[model samples]
Target chain A: MFNAIVSAGTLGTALDSVSVLVEECKIHLNDDGIAIRAVDPANVGMVDLTLSEAAFESYEADGGVIGVNLSRLQDIAGMASSDDLVHLELDEETRKLHISIDGLEYTLALIDPDSIRQEPDIPDLDLPATIVLEGRDIDRAVTAADMVSDHIALGVNEDDEQFYVDAEGDTDDVHFELDRDDLIDLTAGPAHSLYSLDYLKDMNKAIPSNAEVTLDLGEEFPVKFHFDIAEAEGSVTFMLAPRIQSD
Target chain B: MFNAIVSAGTLGTALDSVSVLVEECKIHLNDDGIAIRAVDPANVGMVDLTLSEAAFESYEADGGVIGVNLSRLQDIAGMASSDDLVHLELDEETRKLHISIDGLEYTLALIDPDSIRQEPDIPDLDLPATIVLEGRDIDRAVTAADMVSDHIALGVNEDDEQFYVDAEGDTDDVHFELDRDDLIDLTAGPAHSLYSLDYLKDMNKAIPSNAEVTLDLGEEFPVKFHFDIAEAEGSVTFMLAPRIQSD
Candidate 1:
């Protein structure tokens, strides 16, 4: 059994972070909090999220896993204002989630966890470089790159101690860079990879503009983005495969 | 030659008011200001607009009419903020309009005035009931009615001295009324007519929510909406033919 009250914005952002990669997700609830892990059909992107009990205004739960359609949940959450509190309750008998905000009550049928794809193992990679910056900065870079090309290159110039995003289109190219002076934090190293902008653009939407996002990068390797949500009570990490660059 | 500088919002709103009914318009310029009269292709709606010299920051003209694509002009105007000043210069030799906002300049080719549809004469009608209300109130009623039906009935109750908007759908109906106590002004008469919601929805988007709109209604006659724009320096009147109600 799981019952909790959380801010609408928190749940909405968490759902959006995972829905971009998968339509459905198996959310594991325990006395401590909730955890979700899923991967896209193409296996090009993956998301792992955690929401501690501190994220909710009131919480009570016995460890269990429930499957839900992310899009439907997002839509219901969209009906509430960001500051509004949303109450969620699980009905074990009917296996449906009860969501209430203000005076409106919505019932969402749950999907069987057994019907969903098995969660993939999170790979551990020793990335050489780490950079932290405001979400808006990264979102702005992704938006600019999307306008110029289908793929964008992210790299760190160890010598210059700067992180840069670059894209090349048929007729135009875009280059944006920010040095240590502008970034929240940066660990200089030889890290560069090309990634599809389509996935990055979707992921960027879920990132709050004011939040500080930590990005892990390696040469020709997938990149990992980590950010806190729900006032630091929850966190989400997104991993995206790099597109091979032809010399 | 005509050269003028006006607020982006004023120009955008003016263009939108006419574009909802027609794609292209013949703008007549004179020493006093500009005048535009356009009728939709089906003659279901008509727009009469006037922008005086007081509406612009700077004005100069030799009196000429230029045909322009309203959509294209709106697009350029949209690029600027409401407070930003936009400069417009007519190039008679090239038959093009040069628009400059901030540092960006856009050139739009003019269409031949003679090739466009002729403007129709404004009909003077005697309407018994006149109601003045906030634009937001009208917009809200129209929006709610749109959700339940394709057409809406607008009328005034003589005994109650109230204005009302009603819509009946196959399964649901919406009725909204505002008596003299709630409205800015109302002159009640036996006035009632049904109108297509599709057109009202488009016209509502151009009306500023805070502006006072004067609505003139007559039994089985066109409804006329009048509102001031550009800080009273300009005004727009829209006339929509009523849809005959079936027994």
Candidate 2:
């Protein structure tokens, strides 16, 4: 059983993060908080999200797992104003989730958790570089890259102590760089990697423009993006597999 | 030949006012100003627009008529910010309109004015009722009415001295009323008419929310909407034929 009340903005952001990768996800509910881990069907990207009890106005839960359709939740959330208080309650007997906001009520049928794909184990990676910047900075870079190519290269120049994004098209290219002075923080290391712009574009939508986002990278390896939500009460991390370059 | 410089916002508004009725229009240019009159193919709606020399930052013209593809002009206008200055020059030798904004330049081939549809003669109507209100007020009414039906009735109640918009759908109805206190001005007359919402919706997009719009109506007659553009230096009038109600 689980019940909680949260601001629409917080709920929308959390749902958007997971929904970008998967339409359906298994939500793990516990006395301490809620957790969701999902990967896109193509296996190109994955998202791990956790919302602590502190993220909610009120919360109560007995450890359990439930499958939910993220798209449906997004629609209901779309009806609410950012500041509106959203109340959610799960009915164990009926296997449905009850949602209420400003007198409007909706009962969303939940899927059996056992039917969902098994959650994968989170891999342990010791990346060599770390960079922190405002979400909008990276979002803008991703947008510019999309205009030039389907994939973008992200790296750090150790000598210059700078992070850069580069996209090369058939005849055109785009390059963006942010030095230590421009970034919140930077750890220059061997961090050159290429990733698909499609996945990055989708993930960027979930990040609030003003939020500080951390990126961890390694040569030709997956890039990890981490950002706090709900005033740092909750957090989300996205991992995107790199595209091997061909000569 | 014609040469002019105007703010993107003023030019965009002028083009939008005419483009909504016809995709191709004959622009009549003279030393004093510019004028356009066009009717939709279905003859259900008509637009008359005028922009004086005062509307532009710089203006010069020799009396001439040029046919233009509005959709192309709109695309060029879309590239400019509302406050940006847009330059237009007619290259008589090439019969092209040279448009430049913020260093970006485009030359649009002009259509032969003789090849386009002949201009329509605007009918003179003696509508008895006159009402003036904020563009947003009517826009809201139109939006609400759209939710209920395809056609909306616009009328002024002589006894109540109020103007109202009403729509009836298969299962629901919407009604909005504004008396003298709620309007900028009102002159009651026998003015009850039904009009297609499709036309009003398109016309509403060109009306600035803060603009003071004047409406002239009569019993079962076409309704005329008049509003100023370019800070009163230009004006647009839209006339829509009423959908006769069959009892």
Candidate 3:
């Protein structure tokens, strides 16, 4: 059995982060907290998220896995205000998740865990470049790039210790560069990669504008974006494969 | 030659009002003001709008008729903010309208006034019921009705001096009533007419929420909606043919 009360904003953000990659996921509820790891059907992107017990107003569990429809949960969460407290309860007999917010009760039928795809194993890699900055800066750069092309190149200038995003169209191009002074932190290294803007646009919505987003980069390799939520009580990491640049 | 500087909001509202009925129109520019009267292609609805010279920040014009594509003008207006000042100029030699807003100049090709539909004569009707209320209240009623049915019945209760809007769906219905206290002014008469919600929804966008909307109604007759713009310096009137009630 499991029950918890959490801020609507935190749950909504967490669901959004996972929903961008997969429609359904298996959320593991344990004494430690709740966690989900899933990958997109195209195998081009992956998301892993965890929320500690401290993130919730109240949490109790005996450790079990619950299959959830992230899209349905997101729809219910959309009705709640940011400050509203959401009550969650599991009905073992009916295998449904009950969510209550602002006097509205939504009962969602749980998906069968056996029907969902197995979670992807997180890989280990030595990424040479690391940059941390405000999420809004990256969001703005991606939005500007969308006006020009379908793909964007992210690169670090080792000599100048600057990070830049560039997108070139048939006749127009957009470029945005940020020096060390504009970033929260930077570990300069020679790194560059091209990624599809379609995934980045959806991921941007899940991230808060003011929060710090740490990016790990390598040449033509998958990129990792990590950020904290629920006042550091939760963390979300997204990895997206680079698109082959056809010159 | 015609040149004027008007608030983007006023121009946007004016364009929106006419665009609902016709894509292109003949704008009558006079020493006193500018006006346009056009009917929808289906001839089911008509819009009449006037903006006095006092509505513009600066006005200078010799009387002339200029053809305008309201859809194209609305697209240019979309680039401006509500408070921004939009400069409009006519190039007599090129027969084009130049709209300048936020450092961007959009030159629109004008159609010959001779090719456009002639303005319809406004029909004079002695409607008995006249109810004046906030535009938002009626807009909300229309929106609610849209969810239940495609047509809405607007009438006044002669006995209670109350104005009401009613809509019925296959299995559900919605009704909203307002007494004299809820309206700015109410002249109750035995009035009832059914109107298409599709037209009302589009027309609602042109009416400001806080502005007073005067509704003129008669049993099974065309309905008239009139509202002011540019702080009473301009006015817009919409007349829609009543839908024949099938019961």
Candidate 4:
């Protein structure tokens, strides 16, 4: 049995982060907290989310996994205001999830966990370059690049000690460069990778503009973005595989 | 020759009024003011708009008719803020209309006046009932009715001394009524008409919420809605033919 109360904003952000990667996920609940790890169907992106018991207003649970439909949860979340408190409860007999916001209650049938795809194991990588900066800075660069091209190259200029995002179109190109002084922290190294902007654009929507985000990059390897949620009571990590660059 | 400067809001409102009915029209410019009269292609609605010379910051013209594409004008107007000044000039030599706003100039090719549809003569009708109220009041009723039905009935109740807007669906209905105290004025004579909500919805977008609107109604007859524009420096009239009510 499990029952909890959390701020609507925090629950909505967590659902949004996972919905971008997959439509369904198995949320594991225990005395410690709730956690989810899933990968996209194309195997190009993966998401990891965790919320501590402190993140909830009230928490009580027996360790178990509940399969959830993220899209339906997102729709219910859309009806709530940011500061509204959301109550969630599991009905073991009916195998349903009860969500309450304000005076409205929504009961959604839970998916069978055995029917869902097996979770992916987190891969280990030795990325050499890392940068930390405000989420808005990366959001701005992604928006500008989307207007010019479908793919963007992220690279660290060791000689100039700057990180740059560049997009080249048939008729025009957009480029944004930020030095160490402009970023919160930078460990510059020879690292460059090309990635599809489509996934990045969707992921950008879940990021809070003023929050700090850390990016890990390497030559022709997957990229990792990490950020805190629920006022740092929880954390989320998004990993996206790089697309092969074409000359 | 014609050269004038008007607030972007005034110009936008004028274009919006005409674009609702027809895409192209003949604008009459004289020493008195600017005017347009056109009917929709389906002949179900007609729009008449007039703006006095005093409405513009500067006005000069040699009386003539210029064919205009209202949709194109709307696009240009959309780029300007409401308070920005818009300069309009007729280039007879080039047979084009030049619109300048905020250092951006857009030149559009004009359609031949002779190739456009002939202007319609204003119909004369004797309506038994007239109601004057805030535009927002009528706008609200229309919006609510749209969700329940495809057509709405507008009438005055002599017994209750009130006016009402009502819509009935297969299983649901919506009604809004206002008494004399709630209206600016009311000439309560027995009147009722059923009109398609599609046209009313489109026209509602052009009506400023805070302004006053006068509606004239008659049994099974066309309805007339009159409102002021450009801060009361001009006026616009919309007439819509009533639909045959199905019992």
Candidate 5:
């Protein structure tokens, strides 16, 4: 059970609209240190992530069966290169992790096994507002919001057939909406909530720009995104804590 | 008129870098519908690149003059998102180039580009032996090659201070040297060549584990990377045509 605020920061950069799913993710022990194995499948979009042996030089693993640090493992996964020396190791006594590649001879420690925690269990939500839109549309709306503001407001009107994402900080407050009919589905009963720009930015990496994405949303509950990674069917869901408004 | 290649065949992936010198580049119209942007400042490293935008949508340039087919543009810049769009116009015939934040958008037309006409040309390099490595490694020998293959060599010499990248095919053979000293320098040479795998992967985006990066070379000719792209830079020295293969 491991959860982390691991962000690939893929949105606005290259990946958008689609969903990423890690079907089988785990932390194991190896001769070197703790090893992490995640089969993440997402569309082969415009971005190709790679890493050199040196970039993953520093690793840490302990225990008879080393513990896995999901975030650090994700970091190393994010830097994978085609020609990289890709290998993972686990510890035996402390249950920590270690990572290394063939290029860099020395194996580096990744992180403390204790730092990684499980994703906060999401309460069963009977959401008041939900909408289904093309992964590409949300990607576009993010672009529009990017034009001026970083803060995005997610809301729904009781009678309206769509959901909206509006960024008011910029002069051109981008209003992105997918009408009920336009969306695969919509259950709008009235809701409102907001989040900062960063969480969305980080969340983008986990989501693809092509899948038909579903928004499991409510006024302030963690916005849930459901989509597929690639040929390997998987999902990367992030629940960002709401940004309490100061004003 | 200057001719360079920047398309799906040659410049095979995303082409941008921050740590290196190549900050900006331009492209324009030619009979073949391509222009060259040389890095006279030796700040350019994207030549013969190749990458593709797997899933892209269509959009018109807002209030811009240059009207180009969206799909055609992908052959040049791969996928783009409006959120990352920068309204760049060249004179009245304007064009909008959406790029990653780390990317510098340089738009130029082939009205009359700076010329590069070598008297004898850079001598038709007779590329001999060549081989295919990971397209991502052309820039990341620092850890994968440098730190590991401190000594560079083509044939198996247990005690040679080097390893070479070779690709032998119907066309030219590509070769790259990675000696301990050479690797030491090449790591730093990223500046001299203004090349960074991190950035190249960002702009032209190629395959990580799938795409095979081909290398070509001779005893004394500059190493040539055979990639696929639909465009090229200009007459400036943004790209380096090997002078001679020597330490």
Candidate 6:
């Protein structure tokens, strides 16, 4: 029953959000909200857990899910508690399922996977153009901007078939441009957008620097990120909404 | 001037070994234990640095390259430092060039570049076969093994054209085998070797995960890792001597 995103990021530290579910002999987990699922046989190992939460209480099918005291589970799991890991165990005496992840392990907290509102509802975005580049390039751009400011502008010029990512502030300015010749593909036309250096960074998350990343852009919209999980036949995608500008 | 490889390792927690030389125009650094001669402008930036090491008691030369600390530079560039960044300006005051980054200033330290090993001589290794994989795959393999143990064994079987990566331990056991059908390409024979997981992680230092990586393997010998820094046209390599079996 320990399933749900448990991250509240400040800065510098990494973001870790995981969801895990247990049913009889099966355990499924998708950490980082990227839907990279892993199934491992429990092999008869039993755990004691009790927790409660709104996400778990709403479930009323044949079984019940509960909100776990993620804080308490964090103790047994070590520093993993900072990220809000929940744990839940089914109670035989009652139809209630007990869960504990963080510290409030009084009952299992059920979450409406659909209602939790993790991925924002992305409209049928008509991206005017796109550029596929190495994640490191974006990282470098972001870091370069970070040297001076907190945001960067991204755009593509169809005439030159060139892509530009630039950030400028009082003390420093960085501009990285690439012609169509360098990329797997570069598609664009008179469209540009500015996104939070942080959000763009979040979408990239823990992806390796040299990994291939596709950037889809609109005048003022979200960004989509996709990457592969090494040997496994799986991929993860993250789409982050854009932040409004002050001026 | 301190720029040396502790060993090949995954660039983790910190790149651990990224540095830059700062000077107004040129500062005659030392010819000591390990002094760096500017090879390409690619390895460093054209201006501004929060380098890690402090250059002290520098000797003279026609040109100068001050060895700044990598971590210190990152800290300043990352804005983690409380002290004002120490900026250096030289006046050709004698043979010694003094410099500082991020507030902590010191008289230049001199070293003989000739005295320091430029590149250690790596024997012309007769590898069984060489294969290239997306850099991230190797990074993931190391991460996967890192989660479970300190040692990982890599092997290839020619008959079926398959490669295997296995890690066995009390808490975890993982074996991943990819046949020719699943890989970019597979050349097999009885070529195999076991290396320290730590060194493999070390090779990741200063490199991003998505860069193209080539793995050179022999039945029971050192593994040489080559990384192509995407678009930079620069390459970094690590020659990891094999770990001898205790038995």
| Span of ten consecutive residues with least summed lDDT in model 3 chain A | A167-176
Model 3: runs farther than 4 Å from truth?
A102-104, B1-247
Deviation (Å) of A27 in candidate 5? 4.2
Number of the top-ranking candidate, with TM-score as the measure: 2
Q: Higher lDDT: candidate 4 or 6?
A: 4
**lDDT by residue (tens digit), candidate 3, A42-159:** 8888899999999999999878999998988988888888889999999999999999997899999999998998999878768999999999887777766675579989999999
DockQ of each: 0.04, 0.04, 0.04, 0.03, 0.03, 0.01
How displaced is residue B15 in candidate 4, in Å? 0.6
Off by over 4 Å in 5: A1-110, A115-119, A170-172, A245-247, B1-143, B146-247
Q: Considering only chain B, what TM-score does candidate 4 achieve?
A: 0.96
lDDT score for residue A244 of model 5:
62
Tens-digit lDDT track for model 6 on B66-180? 4333444344334323223333343344423244444544454333334332323346777886666666556556655565568888778777676667665553344556666
| lDDT, candidates in the order shown | 0.90, 0.90, 0.88, 0.87, 0.40, 0.46
Classified by CAPRI criteria, candidate 1 counts as incorrect
Docking class of 5: incorrect
lDDT, candidate 2, B53-126, per-residue tens: 99999999999889898977876676667999989889899787877765344567789999888888878899
For model 5, fnat equals 0.00
Interface RMSD of 1: 9.1
Tens-place lDDT per residue, model 5, A1-247, is 1111112322111122212223222343222322332222321111112121123333333323233333334444445543444444433343333333334222334344354332133445677776777777776777777778877887776666668788886356677776777788887766677876655664565455666666777767556665544322233434444666666
Predicted complex 3: DockQ: 0.04
Q: Per-residue lDDT of B203-233 in model 1, one digit per residue for the tens?
A: 8887899999999999989999999998899
> Which portions of model 4 show Cα errors greater than 4 Å?
A1-247
Worst 10 residues of 1 chain A by lDDT: A167-176
